[model samples]
Target chain A: DVKVTQSSRYLVKRTGEKVFLECVQDMDHENMFWYRQDPGLGLRLIYFSYDVKMKEKGDIPEGYSVSREKKERFSLILESASTNQTSMYLCASSLSYGNTIYFGEGSWLTVV
Target chain B: AQSVTQLDSHVSVSEGTPVLLRCNYSSSYSPSLFWYVQHPNKGLQLLLKYTSAATLVKGINGFEAEFKKSETSFHLTKPSAHMSDAAEYFCVVSTTGGGNKLTFGTGTQLKVEL
Candidate 1:
């Protein structure tokens, strides 16, 4: 089975602290995505990478940035974590356009 | 552009009764629709998908959804509700020619009463 592994399951950080969430997929898919899920707001895309060195901004890319140094790994970086950034973050990967996508278990982060 | 809307915030049904979860979507062109289920603290799983082939799509765990173009809806249903079926279901929309960006709805929480 294809697997998408998230590095952190839970994390607590102080306000203004830099945070990083890492994801790795074994399927070798070209598309990788980062989304933050919140109550009533649902899952909002933060960023996505379509190639090894390419990245694109999604609808809710306000304070988030992404790095796709390699094809199998994608990382989400929060320059300065804030209280409002506390939410469940999800990582996903897909083969191509409109194909079935797979997700990681998700990382819950809390900024105080 | 494409977007999705899950009609209910929550739905409750008896264990042996039928289950229904409503969804609606809009797009500039023909869109690929999907239903995903997320259990507590787990990753989202694909329940079913509609890629313009069949109007009715069947998924795992006895879940099925029908695509109605006239109503612009893809509603999920199950013949019998099981306690393990309790989870949050999301309606999603994507396009074949539009870079495959996924747009998800707020989700509907299904509660099974035994």
Candidate 2:
């Protein structure tokens, strides 16, 4: 079965600290995405990578950056983590630009 | 721009009863609609999608949704509710053309009682 694995299931970081969330997909999909899920807000896209070294900003891309140095891995970086950024982060990948997407288990981050 | 709205914030039902989760969307053109289920502390799973091919779409776990153009709604329904069916449901919409970025609704929490 296709699988997407996240580096961390739960994380806690101090305010103003830089944080990194990693995701790896086994499907070798061309499109990967990062979204933050919050209570009542549903899921909001943060950043997405179409290919290695290619990235696009989603609706909620702010104070965040992404890296896609390899085909299987995508990383989301928070330049300075804040309390407001605490939420569940999800990673998804699709075989093509527009197709069925698979999601990872998600990483829950708490910034104090 | 495209957007989705889940009319109900919460729905309570007894086991073996029917379930209905309301959703409405707005888009300049035709849109690709989807329903997702998120169990507690788990990732969101795709329940079903409507790509304008068919008005009625069936998803996993015996859940189905009908897309109505005149009403601009894609409401999820199930004939019978199970104890395990309690979870959060989200209505999402993506533009047909342009990019495939999805816009999600706030989501509705379903509670199943005995």
- DockQ (Cα-based) per candidate? 0.84, 0.65
Question: Candidates' lDDT values, in order?
Answer: 0.94, 0.92
**Tens-digit per-residue lDDT, A1-112, candidate 1:** 8999999999999999999999999998999999999989889999998899899899889888889999999999999999999999999999887789899999999999
For model 2, state the Cα shift of residue A72 in Å.
Answer: 1.5
Candidate 1, residues B1-114, lDDT tens digits: the string is 788888899999999899999999998889899999999999899999999898999999999999999999999999999999999999999986556689999999999998
Can you write out model 2's per-residue Cα lDDT over B78-100, one digit (the tens) per residue?
99999999999999887855376
* Model 2 regions more than 4 Å off: none
After the best TM-score superposition of candidate 1, give how far the Cα of residue A29 lies from its true spot, in angstroms: 0.3
Q: Could you give the interface RMSD of each candidate, to one decimal?
A: 0.9, 1.6
- Residue A48 lDDT, candidate 1, scale 0-100: 90
Question: TM-score of every model?
Answer: 0.98, 0.96
Clashes of each: 0, 0
> Tens digits of per-residue lDDT for model 2 on A1-112?
8899997999999999999999999988998999999887888999988899999999889989999999999999999999999999999998873377788989999999
